[model samples]
Target: IKGKIKHFMWKCYSGILPVSCNLKSKGIQLDEICKTCGEAPETIEHLFFHCSKSMQIWTLAPVTWEGLQEDTQNFRGWWNKLCTMKASRMSDSRIEMTAHILWWIWKDRNWWVFQQLKRSAKEVVLLITLLNFILHLSYLNYSDSIFLSLILRFSLHNTHTHTSRPIVRCRATMDAAKSPPSYSLRSKKEPYLPTLQSDLKSRRASKADPNPLGVKTSGKPTDPSRRLRNRCTVSKKSRRRTWSFGYADPIHLKRLGMWLNLMIRKSYFNILNTNKLKSRKTTWIGIFVKGSRFPVAIPFATSWDNDVVLVKVSPRKHNVLAMFFVEITSAIFVCLFYRQCLPGSLSPKKAAGKIVLCFSGNGSRAGKGAEVKRARGAGLILADSETYGSLFLAEAHLLPATSVTYKDALKIYEYIQSTKNPTARIVPAKTRIPAKPAPFMTAFTSRGPNPIFPYILKPDITAPGLNILAAWSEVSGPTYFVDDHRFVKYNILSGTSMSTPHVAGALALLKAIHPDWSSAALRSALMTTADLIDNEGNPITDAYGKPADPFQYGSGHFNPTKAADPGLIYNASYTDYLLFLCSIGVHNLSFTKCPKNPPHPFNLNYPSLAIPNLNGTVTVVRTVTNVGCRGPGVYIASIQPPPGIFVKIRPSILNFSRAGEKKSFTITIKTEGGFTGTIEKGEYSFGWYKWSGDIHVVQSPMAVSIL
Candidate 1:
């Protein structure tokens, strides 16, 4: 029956099993001479499955097909009963395949003894191929019948590709839940047979993983409880990517360490490249500075370190330089790349509606003052020599030259202002040259030992000016070029002149926002609202670096943001001017004896009266008493007050310039009554200089009797 099973199950184990039978060495040869038994041979299975020593296996095979129909002698009858059993086609096929595989094992055992090339069934089963094949089959299907169909298909396809209805022989088959295959080989025969017990123990270990797909062959248990209990868990190590300077970039890795920016342009180039890296999420930021403008790079950088990000910034303007740094730390960190604070430059033409700035002597040589003067004059001439209507307003009145030169220049400027020549109008302004010869000062001439006034206040109101490394005009002389003999394309300059333009530029920005503001209005707003705080949030200082003396810093440094929002400004007018004059005690001139009504104070409403409340006034007076006419009515004085401030004179009008070459004007001032104050108790008097020109006062305001 076993032999028949092998022959019929040929298709199921086609490539896996051998054709011939060989179990004789075990003394279980099916037929050494079978001509008369009329029974088929008892081969491996006949010797085992039918033999009493192997009864347990047969009993386990199936109850009905165990041994009821025929005794061990009827091999043909056993075969018939096995094949006729009622079971699924796949079940029958699996049984057939298993039986054939056993036959192959028996054959291999014989070959090991004779052919000396065989391995035990268990050893061969343990081969990686058997397990791998079974796993592959499991992937395709997971039922008992699925394996049987696969076997049939394998055999039939191997032979003709179109075989149908192949006969299969099976002794008996049992139903078992589909599972991965397990095989055990029959090794050396056992001497003692133990009693058959029905009890079966599960082969799985306590730590075995329930998930077959995740099963590990390393023998480590994957049970959830075991995993939870194990304290020494291993975590996968994170991978890092690195990039070195001047090295070829690796294919798909981001840099791990910080990239140091050494070369100027190259450094910015790397920043730009890294910021725009393919598949990377980085920010694009840039900063550029002009050589002759502000130096915002290094000094500002003193407060920062390498880890702080700085994106690439190129000075787009001529005579400019920049730096760019990129952080490829991660997508999140890369976002900060563009936040680098970068300074930018603007030309006067480009700065319309924006603060316009121009610095003189930024390129002047001063060891030879004459040469410097000549150069300046030449430059000034060129400014007009340019196109017909250049609008570079002349601010010559504000130059920081000697007082005599400054005065002379003002006179010349007044002359020019009185003309209609198209070439004679530039913005009048103060020159903000720094003191000479200091390490960081401009090359202007030095001031006197104790000039009484030190100019060009320090920390010139934080403008976008720094060591503005910018593109210089390469066409210029080599002295202006870089050390490498490149074109004269960069420079560094200083002064309040440098600082002033920063304010002017900010003004341009404000102008762009509010175009209708008057010049005085704009100026007032800028001054009154400027920040009093230093860069470190400390109080701003005077030229002497002391806490803010008003004269030095004038209102304050120009505050762009604050200037934009000034709530109110002291708007001055021509009338306001007259009022200010009257308030300063410019009441009458008869005291100088030049004229009783000296030209009637051209721009005043009441040229002969006293300004109201002139106590805080700047004034002078002269008194002359009569030697003759010693009566009360002999002396009479009249006065007139100025307009706008409504200044009232006590005598209404004053007249007494010719009382013995010493005329006296009694001008009593009336404080604007509606005014409210502590009204500090005091008496007042006055004095005067000349009636028509510069004058000196003989006596201050005198205290009078109060009732």
Candidate 2:
């Protein structure tokens, strides 16, 4: 049963109990001064709830009743509005405790004012908690829900004052668990965060997420990587007085899962409307940066480091001197769209440094650096025609460029129209931007630079792993979480494990097409074929949603179609792998003989090249096998060297007449003479090597970390 004080207060909020003020307004009250305060007007609310002493008691409470909208003035309206939020609003012990305290305050006031038997307050807070504990134990005598019984058993006491709900304690416990396991945070001198087992008892699982992808989603109860915003650092612990309750009630546990956040704010603006995008996203939507006080926009479009110089075309006529507002209908590579720019009426000779602002619904697929270099545009910016958002552009385009939302473009356009020089500053952050637009790094996704072997990278490739619908046991819930309650034939799961099957499936397809391809050749094909740009045409980012380094996403996202028909493969046999292991100091002297002169660590036949440390000059050797996509294929090299470095490749041209012809090439990297060492700390300069062959344009990324 609910507490007597709480039940009485519920009636008052429900308008059943006649408040003194309403009664007085109806000419029923004999005195106007409150009986408890004597200073304020006598009202039902003031006498029991609004008195200074009642408010003080509320302020002193360890836990509080929150999630109540402050707009409602009357008690009945507020109560009814709160109930309408959920069809089945679960129990909130904190609210009940609040009602009980208000009731006690009213009782104490009556005793002092009418009976003249003044006790300071009706009861101390501990006594009320004790009442709740005793009453909770009583529920086990008749209740039959096992999960409910557990909640009641552990709900007797809580130390979670840091948050409105007990989830604060749950998160803190999970974080502490990640800390050194030798000691427990619960055993510390300060108050410890409580466990989740008790808090989870109150949350009721919904029937199923209404989205079509609901079947493929899973829930995360304790993800330490995702921290709660505005969470308090301090908390209090309930006094430890030994208490236990026998198991008398039982309830079946059910699955609890929700879809991965899409982060797209719901809007009604048509995607095709060039000027009518209405963005509801406000400044308050972003989270606070770690050290910065101000919140940043979650980039819906890729952003660049440089500040934008918003410019508009001259109204008279299309001139080459004026910027070409390119509108690309379609393209396979995002960078390739720049080449599609047609010269305006202005002479091509004077259009060398003109800025081009591209308007597109597909702003996500913006140009990378190499493409910008070829197009020779001074700078570029993509404006979405549908919704307001920034694209989180990661892959560095040589030309300074950024993307803006359709709504923001409208703002820029308005500013341009008003002022002759559109001088609004749009500095989209390259990294450390919020959301990075919404945190995408899930806890289940593995991260590296391998801990054991710091030199080698982990996560060689990545495919979509989040909320994937996969085969499952008939008896299990769709989610793998222990608390999940749903039962379905297929389950939505996420983790490093999900990627394994994807790669395995791709490899199987490749094998079916060409059974003779070696394992290394297959791997090389996948690495080279993988798309360097994301669906948005921006560089793929890490779990944090920030632009990722090579260590995070080796090569890039997988492109299955390209991988299946890779024209050039880095064909490495078992001998190559053996030598790679030897270079890493893996050798057996007693059981197996070790080679004295092992292959250089950088000489492995890998699709991508990474020299961890460069002192001055180093040489890397790579051998590729021609797949005979086009007979008698001729290829020429195109090099994009890192800043302050020069690259040289011996025999820049190669011709292959037969399929499966192997050729080796040597690449030498050397620092520019008399060059000043002025790179950011821990920064790795990026460039690429492209071999334009008769039938294929093969590209390989090169990263150089200066020592």
Candidate 3:
């Protein structure tokens, strides 16, 4: 009740209501005089207190209000004083009554203005009193429940709907009981009537396959580049931030749910646009929240410049920034971790103020961001994860950091590798043309027939893991040396390690929402719902700008929205992992009991397909579980076999009728007879097998490594 009173008072203070005086002041040119009295303008003061009807109602109020009608030309000032009055501060009833009277007056005035309708002072007072009485009788938390219901009713009654056009807005009641957030979108275009749930299901399935599911009609897809082009306009304008922490922070925010604990501060949007204006002492950026009647701005005291030099780094063991600060020669570039190239190793001379090019998949964002700042480096160019490219960044980050797609990072890295010189520049966001697409693939994401097991695919999907900002541990310096104990709380980084968590987070969300789904089904959902193509509807590519193979992209880039409702899933069990270990000759890795007769590793029920030793032919078995809406998804297998590989799925037709229903099939990969090239010449080839059903196109990648 107190909250309601404050809200009513705030509305008057904000001056947003279409009162006659406010409208006239804004040049609305409507009738400026009060419609009921035609004697004075309908300002908050006149409408709420000075009006003859309001005066009469106040005179009859339960609480004494003899002073209100006197010197009441300014309602705002009078209300402020009244709020601080002892009666108002001490008695909730006083505040509630004031709000009730003000509400009735405004309500009556609106009725007169909109419909020339009148309710006698007596009747209006009765209604206000009745509402207040009911609120008083209700339980403490029950009023908000009533408010929600009332808001829903109000929307239905007042919202205008067009039969021919799509609704521009959608509302879904969120269930508090659900831990993982759910996504719901309703297209505002006309004549398309798919339910939100059905549309989401199909979208999830299409993310994994070329063919769309559940869609009734077929047409060319909208230009892929344009799908997210509007993002530029949607970028926030300010970096001013507040840090309020209570809820546990999530490293992987895969759902669209409101995060109660995190206070996100992003300065890149303004800093990246510094190229537009001449130099200034401070530049201002604004943060505008939807439905907010106010706008906010954050000021930065700097400019954006491309003089920032960039160099590639790859060593998982050392502080990359610190290494570059000391190494004045390019020979240090060959830093490798153990036997593999990591990010900690580097090469360069007097590289102070030069931005370093770092892989997204190599290290912790916190460690990287801290180290770079301390090293006095100009800036950092973080690329996306090796497996998933498309310049992925942490949604909101700290430090002077930016990113490029995996492919773009690859080109830059190659330029340095070949030319031995690193040249880098930052393009102002405002100067970016709408037509050109940034290359976003990374070249070096670890790919596999699972190093130890030829039948299992290692990477499940891709995400934005390049140049992302995350909270840093303040106890360590950017270099993280025992002697460097400079404490800070944020950093930036990229790599497979970063991308992996992204998928894991999305998986966590999927699990929270679909509590009944098995681990295998979830993995299948993530893979099958992944997009095999880039934004252009073409195959996903590698960092070199060439088309990528399954060995590089695994199942394809990750798509969490679609994974939520993947029409069907591939289910795996603990026994499956055990069998995989046994088949790979590493059964000793497990501590628990193992199945006496472990199935073949190829038959362990995984979401992906990998035939490492296709000497002549290999057969892998898998199972699909139904998880979509009503009715069976009658699907037929269609394969896009990797080059030089012939593939066949036995029992190609899978008809699933109910949720939890499982169907099994075998995929046989055979090498082409005439293709006699050495395994070393062309080690692997890629393609996909899709099960096209009426409502779902469940797809899986097929990687064939020539023996």
* Candidate with best lDDT: 3
What is candidate 1's lDDT per residue for 1-707, written digit by digit as tens? Answer: 24655464553234222222343444654543212111334343344333221331221121123233243343344444556553523344334433544444444344544665523221222221122233333234457435644653363224222133211111111111111122111111211101110111111112211212222222222332322110111112311111111111111001100001000000000111111112211100000111012213221110011222212111122222211111111100000121110122222232222111122222222111122222231111111111111111111111111111222233333433454431211111222233111112111211111111111111112332223332334443322312223343444333222343455455555544544343334444454454445554555532223453222232344557766655333232222222322333332211011212232221222111112224443232223322112111133332222221122223322233332232434343334455543333422222111121012111111111111
Give the Cα error of residue 235 in candidate 3, in Å.
42
Report lDDT (CA) for all predictions. 0.26, 0.44, 0.47
Of the two candidates 2 and 3, the one with more favorable TM-score, higher being better, is: 3
lDDT value for candidate 2?
0.44
lDDT of 2 at 202: 20
What is candidate 2's lDDT per residue for 188-221, written digit by digit as tens? 3212222111111121112211111111112112
- Candidate 3, residues 296-364, lDDT tens digits: the string is 111111112223233222221124233322322121121123111133343334335666655644455
Clashes of each: 47, 30, 34
Query: In what order do the candidates fall by TM-score, top score first?
Result: 3, 2, 1
Among the numbered candidates, top TM-score falls to: 3
